[model samples]
Target chain A: MSTFMQFITTGLRLGSVYALIALGYTMVYGIIKLINFAHGDFIMVGGYTLFFTIPAFMKLGLPGWAAVFIAIIVCAVVGMLVELLAYRPVRKRGNNLTSLITAIAMSFILENLAQAIPAIGPDPRVPYMLFNNDIKIGSFSISVATLITIVVSAIIMIGLYQFTQKTKIGRAMRCVSEDKQAAVLMGINVNKVIIITFAIGAGLAAVAALMYIAQYPKVTTTMGATLGIYAFVSAVLGGIGSLPGAMLGGIIIGIVQSGTSTYISSSMADTFVYLILIVVLMVKPAGILGKNIGEKV
Target chain B: MLNIKDLCVSYGAISALKGISLTVNDGELVTLIGANGAGKTTTLHTISGLLKASSGTIMLDDIDLQKTPAHKIIEYGMAQVPEGRHVFAQMTVLENLYMGAYSISDKKKIEDNIEWVFHHFPRLKERSKQLAGTLSGGEQQMLATGRAIMTNPKIVLMDEPSMGLSPLLVSEIFSIIKELQKSGITILLVEQNAKMALSIADRAYVLENGKISMSGNASELLNDERVKKAYLGA
Candidate 1:
């Protein structure tokens, strides 16, 4: 029973991080219909920002966690720049194939750029531990990092929901997603909304980076690749354009991965995770929560 | 108070609008009637700044519309009810109205405008919380009109407000357009249904193959032999 509880806690923690990252994926996809392959690299950017800023802040007598704000800002700026310089031009002239190729090219650029930077070479570095304490329960203990990750992610998700449902810009974002020309008729600056979307998506990836390091504590140029693939799978599983779907998909995937690792061979965990994706695709191509909206004539 | 002269638009190599000129006086409803692919939608799209004009001027009052971006055109007291009633399908009717007032920042004013829209569109009021996609076709048209009105613009460009609707619903939507015009808003209406458009419009222009083929008083055009044969089905 305790063993089961331990796996559950671990799963929840991992799921929270995946959910945060998956949100960035889903939101960008929702607004632009582009997969934003570079979204995962935003997480890597956040990790490196923290790696550089945490020690600098600690040296200046500031708490290491203060670097999180810096990481978020840096990632958001990077994300916006990527959108403007790399994606925007291609978006105007190209079809889905062109934009998709641009996104993939962006991902490669970010990964190789990080590797080429002398200060952030391909070597893996240990991240500063933000929360190390654990809470003891009957026969099982949960780390402070795990509790904080789950709680913070939940709060952010709720905040995001309210922003989308209740705010003006939020409504505009929804409008743009539904129909770009209609949104323009409503006086929405489609480009500005897209830039904001990239900013928010990248900002969330930064928070995911924080949660990720709390558990894995490793920073590398290619760290975002695996994490990005997992989170992308989570987003697809949830229904790519649906917010609640992404959250639900991430949790299910985390639990499945944890359960498989604990009971089955650990080496077979990724295999099972991928198998679930294939099964879901075959059964429900639009995903668990996605509605197959037909095109109107 | 909207004017367009010699407006030409091209989609890559193919021209959609060739030197089309028209005007809508303040508080008057002007209808542009044409068959499909006759540049009616192209005219509205150019006026709304959605498409670039190859040559000519679009003057909304004193503002040079050609210089304005698509999103900024609404701020100059002009809005469009795009063809197909493109309501935000995933949003609620009320939320759709809120999006219409995207240019206005005042909270109380937005609230007032929403109330005005609700007063005009009572059906929309009843389904304010319902997702727009779930609404019937006629209701979506009403919501689209209400959303454009939420901007409180001096002029509106409506594209095929009667498309794909039943005869009963068509009359209902025309009545709503009549009500909107009676409220002193300048309107430029585009429609394939010439009889319905002519019945309500003060003046009319007939477009064919990207040019203004004919222009006259709406009722006179309704009686004209050529218009009757080609459009009125008389």
Candidate 2:
């Protein structure tokens, strides 16, 4: 039972991180129908930013929380730049194959650029520990860092839900997502909404990165590649464009991964994750939360 | 006031609008009557900034609408009820109406506009909380018109408001449109139901194969022998 509790806590911690990153993927895909392959790179950028800046902020007598805020802002700007520079030019043509290729290229550029830059190099660096304390309850015990991650993830998710429902820009996002041409007729600046969607997704990804680095304590230029793909799988598992689905899929993937690593074999964890994806797809092609929307003739 | 001159549009070698010229005076409800593929929809699309004119000038008051983007065109006080009542299907009727007032930021004004829309289409008010996709055909058309009017546009470009509706619903929608015009909203209506459109419009233009084949007062065109043979089937 104690071992089970340990795995559950670990799963929840990992799930929150995956859910955050998955949101970035789901949102960008939801709005523009672009998979945004480079979205995962935002995680690496955030991890590196956190690794370098948190210590510097500590030296300057600033709190660790300030570093998280700074990383989120920087990563958001980077995401917007990716959209403006890479995606915006080809957007007018509305060609899927070109956009898909652009996304893949963006992924490689960020990975290679990070590796080439001496300051950020390919070497892995351990992040400064944010919470060394642990919370205990009878037989179950968990790290304060993990608790913070779960709570922060929940808060961010709830805030996002409210923002989508209440704000004017949020309504515009929904309108654009539903019908781009109709939205245009309604006076919505579709490009602006797309940019903002990328910004918000990347911002959330930064928060996920901070949580992930804090738990794993390692940052590398290539980290985003695998982690990003896994989070994307989680997004698909839950329902690519559905917010609640992303969260649910991330948790399910996290639990499954932890279960495989703990009971089965750590080496075969990814294989099993992909297996789950295949099974889910075979049963319900639209993911768990997504409804089938047939195109009107 | 709207003035379109020598407008030409093409879809990669297929000319959709070929040098069509027309004027919609302020407060006038002008209908563009034509069959399918007659450039009626294209003309409205060009005026609403959906399609860029290959060579033409669309002047709305002092601003050149031809140069504007589709989104910013509404800022110049033009709104379009696109064909098929393209309401945001996944959204609730209330949310759909809020989208109509997308450019307006003042909270009070948006609420007021929504209230005003509900007053015009009280059925929409009852279904305000319901998803727009579930509404019947006639209700969807009403919601579409209500949404367009929610913007308080200077000129509402309506594309086939009576499309895919029963005869009863057709007359119902046209009457509501007439009432909207009576309330001082300028209208540029496009319709394949030429008989109903011509009967209500102050002036009308006949489009055939991407060009304006005829233009005159609505009643005169309604009585013309050529219009009777071709459109009215008299």
Candidate 3:
């Protein structure tokens, strides 16, 4: 029973990472109706940012918390750069083909760039371990850092929800998502909203990456590639445009992986995940939270 | 007051709004009627800052609306209810209405405006928590109008509000529009249903292939044989 609890707790902890990464996918898909395949590379960039941030953090004699703050900021800027350079110019109609190719190219570019650099090339590993052992709660155990990350992830989601619900910028983003022409007629700057969407999505990715390496204690050029694919799967599982769905999908996927790995072959955990996804898709193509989308007649 | 002078809007090589001139006095409800692709919507789009005027001036009171960005046009007190009742489908009715007052920063004023929207759309009040996608077509139209009114603009532009509605709902929507005008809000209505639109309009313009072919009092244009054959389907 304790072992089962441990698996569940650990699954929930990893679920937070998937949830954060999934949000980036959902938000971009909601706003622009585009799948930013390069989003995973954005996560990789964020991880590297955290890596470089440690030396500066130590030089300033800052505590561990301060280092995280610096890392998040740097990662956010890197995300914005990806948007300005890679995504902005190809936003016109009928540019989806080029954009898709561009996104794939960008994903590989970020990965290869890290591989080419001597310091980070080939393989990357965390220089220091930031997390202590699990904190126990009634025999269910979870790491302190993982617990903090899960809590922080929830707070970020809440912040995102509030912004989308309460602010003008948020309203504009929704309007654009619903109908770009109508949004334009209502005096909304669609371009600005799209840029902001990319920024926020990138920022979330950065936070997720920071937590990711803190627990795993390793980083590499090719990091976040498989994880990025899974995050996209989570977004689809939940409903690509629905925020809550993304998080819920993440938790479900995490639970399946952890649950299966515990009782079955750990090496076949990925197969179980894919099997679940296939079954879920066959049952409901729009996803658990995703409604069937249609255009106004 | 609004003045659109010598406005010409083109989509690629095809002109959607030719060199057209028109004037609307303060506190006047005007309608533009035509068949599909007759440029009724284009005129409104250009005036509302959604589309740029290739060569023209769109003046509202003392300001040149043609030069302002689409996002800032609402600051000049003009709001548009786009074609087909374009409410944010995923948002709750209350959230949809609140989006209309996005530029109005005063919290109290925004609240009062929301209350006023609820008052104008009492049905919306009962369904405020409901997702806009779930509403009936008529209700969505009402919500769209209510959302536009929340801006408290001097003028509201609507494109085809009566489309895709039952006759009863059509009458219902038109009466509410009339009540809005009676309460002293200028309206720019673009429609394919010329007869219904002209009945409530103070003045009317007939757009033909991107140019104003006829302009006069609503009653006079309603009686015009050309309008009768082309738009009224008489």
Q: Evaluated with DockQ, which candidate comes out highest?
A: 1
Task: Report the C-alpha lDDT of model 3 over A1-297, residue by residue, as the tens digit.
Answer: 887876786677678888899999899988877788888877787777777777677778876555666656666676677777877776664477777777788888888888998877777767456666678777567788878887888898889888987778987888888878767656677888888888888878888887788788777777779879888988998888999889988888888788888888789889988888889889989888988846453
Interface RMSD of each: 1.3, 1.9, 2.0
Q: Which of 1 and 3 is ahead in TM-score?
A: 1
Tell how far residue B23 is off in model 2, in angstroms: 0.7
DockQ of each: 0.79, 0.72, 0.53
2 or 3: which has the higher DockQ?
2
DockQ of predicted model 2: 0.72
Q: CAPRI band of model 1?
A: medium
At residue A60, what lDDT does model 3 achieve?
83
How do the residues B1-234 of candidate 1 rate in per-residue lDDT, one tens digit apiece?
A: 898999999999999998988989999999999999999988988889888999999999999999999999999999999999998888889888989999999999999999999998899999999988889999999999999999789998999999999999999999999999999898999999999999999999999999999999999999999999999788
Ten residues in sequence with the least summed lDDT for candidate 3 chain B:
B96-105
Work out the TM-score per prediction. Answer: 0.98, 0.98, 0.93
For model 2, how does the per-residue alpha-carbon lDDT over B1-234 read when each residue is reduced to its tens digit? Answer: 999999999999999998999999999999999989999988888888888889989999999997788899888898889998899888899988988988887889889988888888999999999988888889989988998987789999999999989899999999999999999999999999999999999999999999999999999999999999999999
TM-score of 2: 0.98
Reference-based lDDT, residue A99, model 2: 96
